[model samples]
Target: MKTFKSILAAILIVGTAGFLMSCESELESKGTASIGVTDAAVDAENISGVYLKVNEVQATAQGKTKTVVAFDSPKTFNVMDYQSGATYDLGEGQIDAGSYSELRFILDEGSYVKFKDGTTADLDVPSGTTSGYKVKGDYEINSDSRTNLVVDIDLRKAFVKTGSGEYKLRSTARIVNKDRSAVINGTVSGNTADKVVVYAYEKGTYKESETAEPADGESRFENSINSAVVANGQFTMAYMEEGEYDLIAVAYDENPEEDTYAFRSASEVDMMVAGSLLSVLKVEANANINVLINLDF
Candidate 1:
């Protein structure tokens, strides 16, 4: 009877060891990946929200692509509400450990924009729902580690007006590992911050036009290095890399077709870095950049 009991105990120990080994092996098979979606500053007057349905998020690895995680049911997001560095976390999932080169978003149809004037317009996609909007960036996934990837949607540039009261969708996305990106936020208070169009040009960007026939420095051809709409006097331009930029604020004189615009710069602020929130002065990683735009037009 004692011998039988010893044999049973050994069997149980062996079974437990096998189960533990199997669990560890399964855990090492994949890595944790979390993705977040955010929007850049979008200034559209009386525009309450721009909504789109995200079908799926795909990742490309070693010349092959797969859906890391997907919304079982399509998820709709208001791009305007997500502005000012606000982000929507898509949660985390496990993916094979490796280097990923590209991230693609399948933005399906059923997109629309709401105006505060009690009007709604359907956002048209030139290509329909056939293709996915892609942002190319590199990221690595290691075993038992978290890889955070962020995708910033620039609504100001993405939503383009066509002919009449219609608009076409052309997505312009910026993908970055959370560690390498930063946000720049501020308030443009003065005559009309909502009417102001702010531009953030690189350090070496020209104060003078590089092309001829330059119309008062703020040429349509010049194109500010980075531009965003000042919504209700509050604005934010996210995903600015680590570098210096010159801020140029412009308030246009009413006429929609008129080219007349007023330019204004802050009293004592110019340069900023990435990874932290900047209010008025510079912080370690990000910054909040407030510009009191006194438009004298």
Candidate 2:
């Protein structure tokens, strides 16, 4: 009897050891693996379409809030028809920041890219043009909250196709620090299209502008300025030394009668500078003078 009991106890102990070994082996097999982590890539989904309108423009030679019929809904005009319309969709993965990588807009009968953050683009359509634009700048998505986007546009690019029909517009825009903003506006007539080359400079005219230039020899010329097309009629200049300086808009038309690099107008109010800021100055004359360039906020 004693031998039988010892044998039973020995069997039970063996069985328990085998069970424990099996569990240990199973754990070792599974324990060699680890958890994984990843982030899904943004895809081309949720983007239905894109629509734009233009009711006003601000140019270096002209500044007005003229109402036009082109500020309507989508489908009336197709700027991307040449690219199979669907290619220009601006939702979900189609756009990064505010600009599109594979974006195709029927501009000047061709397409241009809006890369480089804070740089404005100018697009021109038949009989119209957009200016003071950037592909990446301050923007919001779905109005959820305000965030800086990779794309932006001013009046120059917004007014490119306002006239309807098959026409071409010329425009540009740019991005700079929030503390600096400047604009240049101009018009290209049907004849003088090829003979125009424009350039801009800053001139300070105050105590704080002691280092500013006043056109030729006004003061110090800071080379950090930037320019871009904002919309059909607006061009933004940025990154200027904070002080009162002339925002000189020069146009070079090859006509012998107008061959000099001339100002867009005479009443052009030279800037009275102080600190780094952003202001939307109105262009209203052959040259506007003493026009308050409000750079607040």
Candidate 3:
């Protein structure tokens, strides 16, 4: 009986060792996926903050969705704080090494916008709490390595003001592998308008409807891949994937009575037309290209 007990104990020890080995092997096959959030400048005036409450960040690979960052409680982020190539680190976690096709943020309730007049309005995120916000991109995760991703929430196209003066979040965001993206730096000269916005659209993707006035609770330039607010005659559209883009420069005039900026007519610029093509840019991974929009020409 003593001999039999000894054999049983040895078998148990072997099984435990095998289990640990399997766990270690599984861990070794995983890689870390880190995520962050950022925003392009909003075109509206008097908006001091655009806040979003995120409960989880997810990555989808091969039709499977896995959480990269799961907060114990909802985390509130002022997306405007991260602009012009800046990012707010969401979190990171181990995921199976492979190619991921999409990234998304599951938002919580209580999201709102703060105006400069000391007033705050709740932002209605349609299906944000349930379906979440999705950004499509191609990302690769190698075993034992870390992949960093940035979700560009182009607020200029996402924030919509309805006829009732209520605000809504209609995000048109994109995800980029931070390590494998490019930047477009540009300078716009002879733009005397109150404000200028540069939009980057995929080559051959610009449509006439994008330039027209949008319907109530909608936004123009909603199909743009990204945008940059021309500040001090300079703009930077960062985190773009390797591809060709058509840059469109638009001019705006401030209407203080309405507390907003109106799209300036192309006739106002005379020789320099607004909403004209600035350039057709082709970029590769990690490329930094500078372009000059000389409207004075």
- lDDT scores in order: 0.63, 0.27, 0.82
Between candidates 1 and 2, the one scoring higher on lDDT is: 1
Tens digit of per-residue lDDT, candidate 3, span 1-297: 999999999999999999999999898889999998889978778899999999998889888898887999999989899998999888899888888888878899899999898899898888778867777777888889999888888888788788998888775777888999998787778778887887887888877667788888778877788888888989998898988777777778888798888886432111122355434677799988777776532
Badly placed stretches (over 4 Å) of model 2 are 1-147, 157-165, 169-171, 175-245, 248-264, 271-297
How close to the true structure is residue 39 of candidate 1, measured as C-alpha lDDT?
70
Which tens-of-lDDT digit does each residue in 1-297 have in candidate 2? Answer: 999999999999999999999877654432110101111111111211112333222111122121111222222222222110012222221111121111112212222322124332333343322432112222222222222211122222222223342222223333222223223333322222222222233333213332332433111212213223112323333222233434433222234563323222211223332332323333322222222231111
Leading candidate by TM-score: 3
Per model, state how many residue pairs clash. Answer: 6, 92, 0
Whole-model alpha-carbon lDDT for candidate 1: 0.63
TM-score ranking, high to low: 3, 1, 2
The residue-by-residue lDDT of candidate 1 on 52-164, one tens digit each, is: 77777778887787777788787788876765556787667788888888777677778888887778899876544554666667788888888888776666556655546
Residue pairs in steric clash, candidate 1? 276-285, 276-286, 277-287, 278-287, 278-288, 279-288
In terms of TM-score, which candidate is stronger, 1 or 3? 3
- Tell me the lDDT of model 2 at 251: 29
The local lDDT score (0 to 100) that residue 250 gets in candidate 3 is 79
Lowest lDDT block of 10, candidate 3: 265-274
